[model samples]
Target: MAKGHRSQIARLRNENKDTRPSAKVSYARVSVTKACFVLDAIRGKDVTTALGILAYNNRYASSVIYKLLKSAVANAENNNGLKADDLYVAECFANKGPTMKRIHPRAQGRAYRIEKRTSHITVVLDEKK
Candidate 1:
């Protein structure tokens, strides 16, 4: 805690904040590995190309990521005052979320645990420099 006024400290924090536009989906039903497959395809591609890839991809995660990517693009355009054409997928990844455990009954009275995994997926976009 350095000596500074409250407003000044807030200003300093704002200066260090990441200005890039991004979107995240929490507790997405898809697993990290599956989401990463879609994320990997569009990680560095331009927004238009990324959308195109997402549009035609057959993976379930692609549909979720596609909507998330669209939201990120809208954020870049509206919130960041950036043009859609100049934006690209700068960074994107998925993180593990809470795992929901379910019980599967086996033969007799044996119980087996089944994990319904969830993930938090994020897509960060930046303007092409």
Candidate 2:
């Protein structure tokens, strides 16, 4: 249990919040492994180079992450008042989200469970010091 009132807890939580600009896509219809392949490419790269990598990559997750990266860059510029040129991907990851289960009928009327996995992808951007 928390040791503070509701308002106090809210204020304390807000104080420790991450200040770097970022963007997240919840319930993205891509698996964590696939998304990590894209995230690994741009983890520490500058925004322009990261975008370039995403632009040419042929992976499906790259497309989703491409738009997400752009949104993060825009967030840094508009919300954080930071220059896009100075920003790099500080942290980018995909966490597991809810899995949608589907039934796949097999031989002898056997039903197999097919899981359609989803992920929550996040891209955090920070200015180079």
Candidate 3:
């Protein structure tokens, strides 16, 4: 039983064994749905091409994602010793974060709940094989 538990722990630790460099932006002031729109455009694209798309995109989320992508590329080059020219976006995603709640005053002493959504974004880059 002890041997089985130890093996399971080892496997769990190795689950994220990928050497690709990644960057994350937590609690960004953007909704997950909005961020996903930008993330979808960059996935599987070369670093240069992805930057081009992000640079020209008009969405507000694109601006935030653009910075995050650049950080990931820099991480790959400096930390992972990978070439920026050969890097591609292996994965990009945005997850929902805690929402800030506020009350809006309405007519007749009524109050309306307002939610400001936030997201956590991650970008992973890998070298072309």
Candidate 4:
């Protein structure tokens, strides 16, 4: 096999063997910009702290993301046999989703275009070292 192929195989072999499971929420009603605000707050926070932050957040998107976080935590516990206290926000991000276009009635028989936004959110938990 080529050197590049050998390296790729080795990389995969060295990856974490833990069975930690993650959950994703796609096409959420929240916008990417709004979701990013919540993600930033919990990027490096511990599981407990992150939950606290989400609980107190007044933003609309926080509710949705908090539910996703809980789901991921449950996945890690039930699927991977990991403890909630040992998990952290390893990776969390929101990407822009498809825009739904609609027309609004306007004066002079003209229509105004409106774009409703959506977001794709993902949460990944890892076992703390």
On residues 1-129, what C-alpha lDDT tens digit does candidate 4 reach at each position?
536687787787678454556789988988899899999999878789999999999999999989999999999888888899988998899989999999999999999999899999998889889
Clashing pairs in 3: none
TM-score of each: 0.91, 0.92, 0.89, 0.84
TM-score of model 3 relative to the true fold? Answer: 0.89
Summarize candidate 3's per-residue lDDT along 68-121 as a digit string, tens digits.
999998898889898899999999999999999999999999999999999999
Model 3 spans > 4 angstroms off: 1-16
Candidate 1 lDDT over residue span 18-41, tens digit each: 989999999999999999999999
Per-residue error for 83 in candidate 1, Å, reads 1.3
Candidate 1 versus truth, CA RMSD in Å, comes to: 1.7
Candidate 2 local lDDT, 42-64, one digit each (tens) = 89999999999999999999999
Pull out the clashing pairs in model 2.
none
lDDT on C-alpha atoms for all candidate structures: 0.95, 0.95, 0.93, 0.89
lDDT of 1: 0.95
After superposition on all CA atoms, what RMSD does each candidate show versus the true structure?
1.7, 1.4, 2.3, 3.5
